[model samples]
Target: MIEAPLGDPIHHLLTPEALRHPAAAWEPFRHREGLWWSEVLDSWVATSLADCSAVLADADRFCSDWRKLGNDVPDSRLTVQILDSPEHTAVRAQLVRAFRALDWDGVRDRVAENVERRLAAVADRAAFDFMAEFAVPLALDTIVDVLGVHPPEDHRFPVVSAQIVDSMDYALRPETVGPGRAARAALAELTGQWLDGRTSGGLVGHLAAHHDSGRVTTAVLRNSLRVVLHSGYESASRLLGNALLACLDSPGSLDALSGGVDDTALQELVRYAGPVQAEARGCVADTEVNGHPVRRGQVVTVLLAAANRDDRVFDDPHSLRLDRTPNPHIGFGRGPHACLGAPLALLLTRTALGALAGLPRPLRLLDQPRFRRNATLRGLERLDLGWG
Candidate 1:
């Protein structure tokens, strides 16, 4: 098999077809050296686990805020992801406290209830879009409930939030940039209203309290909320879709999951079916990674999904084995910017899987799962299943 030029596959990555079948899309680059410079991305693609980890862990050299690359990122102020430490550290501490104070048991109960309620609605249908009917609703409702915020009257958060995050894709077209900025502005105003009305309890309440105490600023609170809500709202939902598809594709794994496996199995599942495909980081200073020189102002896209499948890291990397131990997958990322909602995501996924196990056995896919057209995020838009 001949390797196409590095830039040739990015257009494919922007489509649902590439997301639905990543192996086929990425197979051409499987043997490419450490970092392939993609003229399309105008950045280097880090596919090895070690290289990706190096880029993510060294924030001093590689920054999370891609705006530093000089692109006009509208509403960039509405997020902390762009801030470097010690600013990032102080703000992150406040958010971490707020997250830690959340009642996990209560959140878990609500999530499980939400999962059951959704499953009940489609339990008898001959065929249903599992993502639309179950996964998306479950994730949205859980996010609202956990944050203790009333659902927006317009129900536009899902669409807007997705667009905002999708705009971060390395393969984004010029036409998408404007809409993403507009979505960010709309979401910020909506969240501001929610924050103003809040008193105590939930995430909004905690943030309000922190703001009152003068520990966190209003801008920080708003931006942090925007980032958390957007990420929390979508990441787990994508993971849920991916994990379910993983079980369905792997024979007998559903039985093992239904019978209850330990956290190791869950970890391995994430290692095998990573949801957050790739993350872009800007080079903060001239540095060397894997002996390759990287200059300041350049962007590096770390392929997390690809790294998780690196043959050097796992035995039979392509196969999903629940018992795989010492799984050091960076599915949630690593170091300072590791996913803040990882525990919550894990709880939600475990709950969803448990609820799925309760479905009538002999489950069958009515059709192959369909993914939404996105490059930065991989998630199902429809998963048709029949159990009768």
Candidate 2:
């Protein structure tokens, strides 16, 4: 692993400005013809649409198990994200089944209910902080239902999730290491409450069955559940707020999605404001990215956000066209390690938007949106909106 000089503090592409306005922030990086080196991760960051797609598709050449490249794995517990193929496939197959087992229609209805409750709570207010009052709790409630946890009203979940958020931002803010670790431990302990293998419904039932059949151990199950809670909560909340922010900004975009959920329009929103920005893959064998040789043991970070707006792939790459067809944006990525929570995000957002459309009066942005300090999961910290 190459190291930065002691005197020169390393810098990264995900700066504070980038986190706030990513679409414009990533413009310069995308302008670069090909792979660029990240001094922080000591890896080549792929920017072009073709290059990012190629890396994600050919997982064998670009392995997800980045540990071989010598950077310490973020979480010692083995989660599906970094596992190599065959093993990843086996685990993923079971997870796909568990996900498929969900009654999406039912889940969508519950999300709608959560949205109504939130909206009703702020009915008398002149304005409400959308991110805090609506987005966060709605997503958390739906996730708790899916996980089959009780006292679904627990406030600690979001509090813990918020604290550890910086942990995932270690790539951008190294100071998050200690606090992030503490937050993760607290989240895991709280999530462990649901690991009793008692719930026989929703996603937890599937885990309980796996435990009963000796397919997975209790410790692994606890880690997996914790990952699901933390990851699922953050993804859904951010995607919810970001999508609405984009829709409201674009002329007639929200109305186009007013009455129903259009998958194509939703995909465009994902491309425009998807939280996941980059994925790091370790080069298993020597390979050529855009004809440039990348030695084995080196890492290639695929910039999904940049590729989503690559002009060669999407015309008017920066604009949101709800009607755009043949949308091949990798907002959820492609191939083996594509986002697992994409379906949940879509369901939550679709239900929320559809419900909001039924309101007696249309909502308007009360103030400029502010983003949380995050690199990968770019999201809003607060978004105030009012019916007046």
- Give the per-residue lDDT digits (tens) of candidate 2, residues 143-260: 8888777643555656667766766657667788777677766666665666664777878777666653245445545666677787778998999999888877876777777767
* Cα lDDT, all candidates: 0.77, 0.76
> Which window of ten consecutive residues has the lowest lDDT sum in model 1?
1-10
Clashing pairs in 1: none
TM-score for candidate 2, residues paired by index: 0.90
Q: Looking at model 2, which ten-residue stretch has the lowest summed lDDT? A: 1-10
Candidate 1: stretches off by over 4 Å:
1-7, 66-78, 212-215
State the lDDT of candidate 1 residue by residue for 1-388, as single tens digits: 1223643566678666677776666665555567767766778878888999999999878987656566665454535666667667777887887888889889888887788787778777777887888878778788887788877677777789777866766265666777787787777776777788865788888877776435456776677777777777788888888898988888888878776646998898788776788888899788888988888998888888888877777778878899998898999998798888887778888888876775665567899788877777787878988883
| Candidate with maximal lDDT | 1
User: Which candidate gets the maximum TM-score versus the true structure?
Assistant: 1
